[model samples]
Target: MTASDPSGPFRLLAQCPPGLEPTLTRELAALGIPAPHQTPMAGGVMWNGGWEQLLRANLHLRVASRVLVEVGSFRARALGELVRKGRVAVDWERIRAAAGGDGRRIVFRVSASRSRLYHEGAIEARLREAGELPDVAGVGEEAEPRTRDPGEAEEFPGVAGPGDRADAPGTPILVVVRVHRDQVTVRLDTSGAHLHQRGYRQHVGTAPMRETLAAGLLLQGPLEPDGGWSRPSLVDPFCGSGTIPIEAVLLARRIPAGMASVGFVPRDFACLHWPDLPPDVWEMEVARARAGIRPLDPERFAVFGSDRDARVIEAARANAKRAGVPEEVHLATAPLSKAPHPDDSGWIVTNPPFGTRLGARKSLRPLYAALGRSVQPGGRMVGWRLLYLSADPVLDHATGLPLEVRMTTRHGGLTVRAVAAR
Candidate 1:
């Protein structure tokens, strides 16, 4: 089952939170790719593209959860039909070639939400037949590779042992089959890992938000949709290791999320089966990033951050330097109420430590109240918006400001509310 033609690119599918579908679609549209077709799955969206577009999605998308490529889609009414259709749809030769001629491994994921055809083993067997690969039975058998010896860790090469699957290299073709009612849709996951794990946040503090999530939160605030962070001087009063500020700089410079990342799940995917990706693509991206990078002049626009703990402020400074936006940010050691004042009309966006994650609800009330006062009349302005994630509605009363709750969403298993005061 060789690929139809190496020239014909595979059908790529990218997934993200339902709330972010519109933002992701707009991002793809800017690259000249067609808008993604929406699906009912939670945090799922579908898009089509080749290797270059796939790379661009991984690098540029600020809100997508993960990107997957569609390998095949078929309708199967019964177990036998599933087996037959699944095996016939896979291109074994292409899978083997993508694996660099090694014995290929196939993973089958089945979802039978509203259908009677729910047989996991049969589906796995069908996928195995499709790829012409041997299934190493049982999870325990896979775990045996780790106990061979500490020195044998490197012997397995690309195979991941027990807890380290994130580091595993060499693409294994994954078959994801979702059966809704009587229809089965099978897709091959091209982006192996979620694109958010850019591998830069070596040091993280309590409840550190993901880079992608932080970027989305920022965009939802004062930042423009077209990747511009120039206006409304951004400030993260609770700057935990500076994830938000660092992401702001990346957005300002038009630097793709995964630009500094060395590995992506898509890199190992079989889709690169085409003539090697254009040699200058990467170089051109880098040059574009350099050209678009806004000079990090602290005085130009107020990108300020502050934290009560001096140690956390140190961490934020270090992380900002690593992100190549050290000069663009102003760091200070102070509580949220005392955070440095930027231009009169800037935005205050921070992920304050929630009572659940930070502990002791009673202790944080005073802090929230003070935060409200700091952003009021003489401090910032009527146009200044305080976008924060809080579980306590009492925070509005604590702030003593007549703020309108604009939007709310769940992040890190906590309810986040965005409030705007005009």
Candidate 2:
């Protein structure tokens, strides 16, 4: 066991969507990391922990999009200062030692905002020179050397270059340098892919709900528990690809969201490759998480989904089966006007289509009205409530229900809000 470091700089940054910081904070707490300091609007919660804590996060965090470990921060007024601060000053060996000195192939990236170092290429150049590592043998895709202009340094020594977005395996270290004014904050991305790519949904439908956003909607939205859905009859009338309902059932079952993420990057994570860490640490954690799951009571959790397209229903079924919850999910195909209601009353959560064209949007009113009526048809009302995500207020207005805005967050670069109604 690594001894505790009271004055050590080992810190993990859990990144979530903006405005969902508090929800992620409580989630980390529930998993035994106490009092995560909230970085609101930034979508990150900073907490002190070592390698094990970092591994636990990638295994457990449902709302976090990625987990970043801070490497070092320094003030650099010039390129030379940046290089010096990076290599000798920042203690690269100690940072590598944290990973137990396992040689890794580093892929470095940098971004600058409001900084005097406006030249991103120069900044990238400096980081490469400073924190250089020996290149991995026979790993990573080989590509022709990228040409450099006038004063550019020779080929990036020990760096194998940028990774292919499609095949991300063997990608260990991703150095992120964020420069603002004279300050530079360096971090290593521990989560290789976006957390929402939960590995189960090989198939997807239009405007599909992101697994991270789906998890946030299930965990943080007050309309759920407050609406008396203890076990939650999670219904997504327009359930495209079954992201919401499947995520709900997984959360209810106490299943680690990453349990079946077949190609999860935790094994390829830079620190895990380091020599000092145990080879079975990640496997043991995965096993422990598997042991920790409190499997669902067949009759306890109710999850159902329906869609206008028969194809989407078919897709949802396949996705839910791959997620190992086919028995828990019930799917059907029908237009919104003929949407089926859950026999057992449950809260409704969905990300409705955000029509980009006005004419296309106008045609969606009846769909929204059908949604409103489906929850509380005509005069028959239940204790159940509806929480749906919509991009346009004008679109939501057609639902004809008095929607109280619950939260506003971005979806697919469009500003969207989660509104609740009965």
Clashing pairs in 2: 100-276, 102-274, 102-275
Best candidate (score: lDDT): 2
- Model 2 lDDT tens row, 196-292: 6667787888778678778778764532311223534667778899998888877876677666433222223334544555667677777777776
Q: Which lDDT tens digits does candidate 1 get at residues 286-365?
A: 46544554454555456778888888778887777766566677888987657786655677888877776335676777
State TM-scores per candidate: 0.79, 0.81
**What are the clashing pairs of model 1?**
192-265
lDDT of 2: 0.65
Q: Which ten residues in a row have the lowest lDDT in candidate 2?
A: 148-157
**Candidate 2 segments exceeding 4 Å error:** 1-9, 36-41, 91-105, 133-172, 222-231, 261-271, 279-284, 377-382
